[model samples]
Target: ELFQVGQEVEVVVLDFNENEERISLGYKQLTPDPWLSVPQKYQPGTKVTGKVVSLTDFGAFIELEKGVEGLIHISDLTWSKKMVHPKKVLSVGQEVTVQVLEVNVENHRISLGLKQATPHPLELFAQKYNVGSRLKGRVTNLTDFGAFVLVDKDIEGLIHISDISWEKIKHPSEKLKVGQEVEVVLLNIDLEKQKVSLGLKQLEGDIWEDFFHRQKVGDVLKVKIARLVDFGIFVEIMPGIEGVVFNSELDENKIENPAEVFKVGEERLAKIIKMNPANRKISLSFRQAQADLQKKEFQKYLETQSDRLTLGDLLREQFKNLSSKDNSKKEGHHD
Candidate 1:
C-alpha cells in the first residue's frame, strides 16, 4: 500500500543481467535492520513498554517497536502458580511493562519477562516474615485437604488440613471460609520451591501441650469411655484430649472383660499412672482412683470424730469383737 506506480520511493538495487534484461529491487533493504541494533537497545534487565500483539499456548508476542517483537514466555507471565494461563493475565492490544531478559541478535529473538519487571513477591514476603512470625491473611481458595491464604500481593501460603486446627475436622470449611481473614503463623518458607506454609492452630497453641503442662501423673480426672478395644478402652478426659485405660488397670478380678463392664459414653474416675508428653500419651488406672477416693473419705470421717475415737481405741474395740466371734464359732463346733 505504501508504493504505487506514480509514487516515487527509495529502493536498493540487487542485480542486473544484460542478457536476460532482468533487474531485482528491494524497498525494505533501504531501511536499517532492527536486529542489528537490538543488543545495544534492549539490554538484559532493561525495562521497556510494549503492546501485546498475539497470544499462544507457549507465550505472548509483544511488539516493542515497529519490526521489533519480543516473546513473553508463559512461565514469565507471573510468579504465582495460581495464574496458570497467560491469557488470564494478558490480552492483545494491552500495553504492559516488561523486563528484557535476553537478546539474540543472531537468531532475531528477544526474551521478555512480565513478572521480572518487579521484585518477586515471594522474596519480598520472606524478607518481611520468617518462621514463627504471625500475620493476618485472607483465605483465597479452599480444597478438601487445605486452604490457600493470600498473605501478600501475588503471594499465597497453604494451610494444610492438619494445621488448620487442633480438633479434628472433616474439611477446611468447617473452621474457615473463603475470604475470611484469619491469623496464621508462618510455619516455613521454601524459597527453592517458592512455597510458604502457614498454620492456624499454632496461633491457638497445641491443646496436648497445654494439657500436659497443667496435668501430671497420679492426677484423678473424670473421663468418658470413647472406644473399647481388645487390650483396653480409650477414654476422653476432655474435648480433644484422649487417654487409654488398659484392661489390667481396671478391677480385673471383678471385671474379666472391660468392654463387658464399660460402655461408650459412660463416665468414670481414673488416675493417671503414666504420662509421656513427648508422644502425648497417658495411661490411666480406674482401681487406683477408687482406692484414693476411699482413703480421702476415711480421712474426712476421722477428722469429724477426732475427740470420741482415737486410733488405738478403735483398733482394740475391733480386736475384742473379733475374739468373741472366734470363741462362739469354736464352742458351736465342739457341741
Candidate 2:
C-alpha cells in the first residue's frame, strides 16, 4: 500500500536492461486532498508577500507560493490611477506584498490588491506634488496654447505656452518636448477640481523686471524686430521684453507694409518713444529720433553761412523746388 504520512519513500525501478529507459517514482498520488479542506490550511483575505513573475496590460502575475499565483488588476494596483499601461508602475522580478481580496476555487482564480494593502496614492500625491514643487516629467499632450505634463500616473499639470518660457512663446513645442524631462513650477493645485497649473517661466527670472523697473521713457535701446504686423513691428529690446514700433513712427512720412523695412530679428538702434509701466509696454521709434538729430545738424550747418548771396539763392531755389514737387505729385495722384 502507498504511504500517506507526509513523507517521501523510495520506490523500485520498473522495466529491464533491454528497455531504452527505466523510471523511479514517488508515492504521493494516493494521498487525500488538503485543498479540499483549505480552511484548515489558509483562509480568504490573507496577507501575503509575493514575487512578481510576469506583467500584463491589466496587471502583474505574482507568485505567492510554489504553486499559487494571484491576479492584481490595474484598478487594484493604486487608488489614484489613470493608467493606460501597467509596465510603467510594476516590473517583472520585483517583490510586492499584497492582500488576498478574493479566493475562488471553482475557476481557480485569486484576486489580489496592492492599493488596499498600502496607503492611498492620492494622499501621497498631494503631499509629494504640491505648490512650488519643481518637477521633471514627460510632455504627454500638447494644445494650441499649452501642454500637459505627466509627473506621475494620476498627476499631470497644464503648462501654458506663455508660462512655458521666459521669452515669448508662439507655440508650445518651442519650449516643451514630448517624452522629454522638463523642470516646471507648480502654480496652483485644485484638489477639489483635480487640476494643476504649472509654469516653466516661473523657474527663471521675470523678464519685465529689467525692462520696466530699470528703464524709463526715451531710454534708447538697440532693438530687433521680433515680428511685424499691419499696425506696427514688435521690436525686442531684450530677450523677453518687446516693444511696438508704430508704422507712423517708422519713417518721415507714410509706409506700406511695415515688414518691407523691418524683418524678424532685424537689429536697429531705436529710441524709446513711450513707456507705460502699468501696462508693461514700451513704444520705440528709430526714424523720429534720426529726423530730429538730422534737423539739428542741418540747422548748425546752415548757421556757418560764409557767403550771403549764395545762401539767399540756395534758399529761394530749394523753397521753389519743394513747392513745385508737392503740387506735381498731388496732381499726378488726381490724374
Candidate 3:
C-alpha cells in the first residue's frame, strides 16, 4: 500500500532531512486532534453516547469518537446495586448513554457516570416517605451493630441495635432475625447519605413515662439485682424499669467487692434517692433506706415520751441528771 502507483493521498511530513535528502511521512498526523475541542463540545452534565471499548478492574472506557474516549468508574454505575465487575452491568462493544461528570482537557480525560442518566432511587424514596411513617419490612441482613430491613422493593433501611428493644440487648440478632417480618417506625431519612434510620422500639410507647408516673423519689421498694458492673449494680425495681445502685450506696458497711455482696436475683430494699425521668435513669441507695427506717423509729420513741411529760418537768429532770454527772466527775478528780 505504501508504493501504490499514482495514489493521491494526504501525508504529514514528520521530519525533513535536507542534508540526507530524505522525508519521514506520517499518516495519523494528517487528522486533527479530537481532544482539543472536547472541553467545549462535552462540558460537565452533558449527555453523550459511546461504545464500551474496553473494561478494566477499576472502570470501563467508552469510545466517544475515533480519538476521544471517557471512563465510567464502577462507583458511578449504580446508586444502590453493588457491582463487583463491569461485565456484570456492562460488556465490551455495548453502546451506552452517559452523563459527562467532568472533562479534563489538560489531561485529555473525561469522567462519565451511568447512574446519573436516571432518577436517583434515594430521592424517590424520600419523596414517598418521611420521618414517623410506619412501614412493614422484612429483615434481609444482620450485622454486629444493626439489621438491614427491606422496606421497599429495592430499598433497605437500617435498624440499629440500640433501637431494637426497651431492654438492653447484646446484638440485633437477639430480637431480630433475617427474613423475619416486623413493623418499624422511620426515625430519620438522609437523602445525601442515602441512609434510612428505622426503630422497632418506638412503636412500643415509651415505657419510661409510665414507670416514672407510678414511682417517685424517696419511695422504698424491694428490687432484684439484674446485673453487676464494676461501678454499680443494676436492679429491676419493676418490670422493664431498671435502677442503678452505686458501690458506695450498696450498704452502710464498706464493701470491697460488690459482686460478692450482691448476687443476681438477690432481693433488697432500695430507696429511690434520685429519679430523673428525662434521662430515664433511677439512682437507688440501700444505705439511705436503712438510715430512713432508723430515723422513723427514733421519732416514734420521742413522740411517746412527749405525751408522758410536761415541758417544764422534762427540763427540770434533764438539769438534775446533768448535776449528778458533774458531781461524780468532780469527786473522781479530787480523789
**Model 3 C-alpha lDDT per residue in residues 1-335, reported as the tens digit of each score:** 35578888888999999999999998877888898889888999989999999999888999999889999999988775666678888999899999999999989899999989877887788889889999999999999999999998568899998889887788898898999999999999887888899999989877899878888898999999999998989998866679999989988888998877778999998899998988888999988988888899999988878866777688899999999999999999999
lDDT of each: 0.90, 0.77, 0.89
In model 1, what is the error at residue 3, expressed in angstroms?
7.7
Clashes of 3: 0
For model 1, the superposed segments whose C-alpha errors exceed 4 Å read: 1-60, 63-68, 73-75, 80-111, 228-231, 254-259, 294-335
Cα displacement (angstroms), candidate 1, residue 115, comes to 0.8
Cα lDDT tens digits for candidate 1, 6-74: 898879999898899999998878888888888889999999999999999889999999889999999
Colliding residue pairs in candidate 1: none
| Model 2, span 199-272: residue lDDT tens | 88888867787667788776667887888887888888877778898888888778876767667878887788
Pairs clashing within candidate 3: none
Enumerate residue pairs that collide in model 2: none
Better of 2 and 3 by lDDT: 3
Quote each prediction's TM-score.
Answer: 0.65, 0.51, 0.69
Residue 248's lDDT in candidate 1: 82
- Best-matching candidate per lDDT: 1
